[model samples]
Target: MKVFVFLTLLACGAFAQQGPQCKAPNGGGLQPVLEEFVALIPTDKVLELVLTAMTSDPETQAVMEFLSSSEFYQVVDLVQSQPAFKSLLEFACSDLYLDAAYYFNILAGIFGFPEVHNQTRAAARTAGFRGLLLDILELIPVDELKALLDQKLKSDYYLQVAFQKINSDEFGSIIEALQGDAAYNNMKNRLRGLGVDVDLIIDTISKIFKP
Candidate 1:
């Protein structure tokens, strides 16, 4: 199980996302709706799709309307694991795929939870939260990121290389956010000993938020 790092985000941006775009001449290729939520993806190659998505989506408004409370995050969680995602994950598995615990660690780092609700935005609504995602990441702090990295290493050796590029101060914030939690730090220390730089974990989270 390797903890995929921030660099992967840029790659994810470049590739990874492949979903229906617009209604295609006859009103097709829309996001899957079970009643539904919107996740935008463009048909372009080598482009930043998430940024494009935040601007024009209506499902976002639908999500926002139902957001605003406990159920809000719940829905985000629901969306995170939407069965469709299993297929997406399978589609994306080639770049980095970990089985067992490594996969769970990566899942923890992902922000499937919604940040807020009822806040309307006119910015393309389809653009998704590019900046907001980055800002929210600082919200997780440093140590937790380190601990997460450790979990990744325990499962995936290749991730040790990924950990080499992060910055320390950034990682510290995650630790501080964890408030010296024993479990979190224990994981961090273990990873650190393996030469997994705390900075790499920070960089990955930063990218994930922005990605």
Candidate 2:
């Protein structure tokens, strides 16, 4: 798994070296890079690798178990009970979501992926994804979901254990391997070219696992 991640990073560094071709499109930028990345490594294979790694790690298994616990359901219930959240769900079911979907379809067409555009349009019309979300919102019992948020915030055992695993030397070694000196420099330079604040992003992500 570590080897695969390291190779993937190296491939991305090579892609970063392709000067003009790596540039973002007229209205957007990341899509072209993403397309190139996807071309090199299929999305399904990436997802498979991620799932394999997660399932093989005991700490990740604990985190996944916690996510499916009753307490997590309480968290979901609390969020779903919020008027603001409900409003957002309603908005998603509105024409605005369709507009965004159409916009993405246009982008797919522009990027020379007619199959992607056609599939998206077909799914937008036939798939009941939006309808299912609306139904879930309507079915949630808001009164029952009115539990205090503090009750859920009190437990940090599983999260703390997960963070410990993330901050461990084993995990750090994996990160170091994936971010080898050359690959790290190349990524930073590429992100800078795209006007990203690499230091700020690194700082923000680093804080998440801080003790």
Each prediction's TM-score versus the true structure: 0.21, 0.28
- Model 2 regions more than 4 Å off: 1-41, 98-211
* Candidate 2: tens digits of C-alpha lDDT, residues 1-211: 3322322222212111122221212322222322333354334544443355345544434544544465544443443344433332232223112111222233223322221111110111112223222232333332222221122223433323333444556545645543544534554464454333444434432332123
Per-candidate RMSD, Å? 20.4, 24.1
**Taking the tens digit of each residue's C-alpha lDDT, what string does model 1 give over 1-211?**
0223323321222111222222223221111120021112112211233233334544433333343345444543453344333333332232222121223233233433332111112133223333323333334434544444445456544343224312334433432434344444454464354333455545654543231
Best by lDDT: 2
TM-score, predicted candidate 1 vs. hidden true structure: 0.21
RMSD after Cα superposition, model 2: 24.1
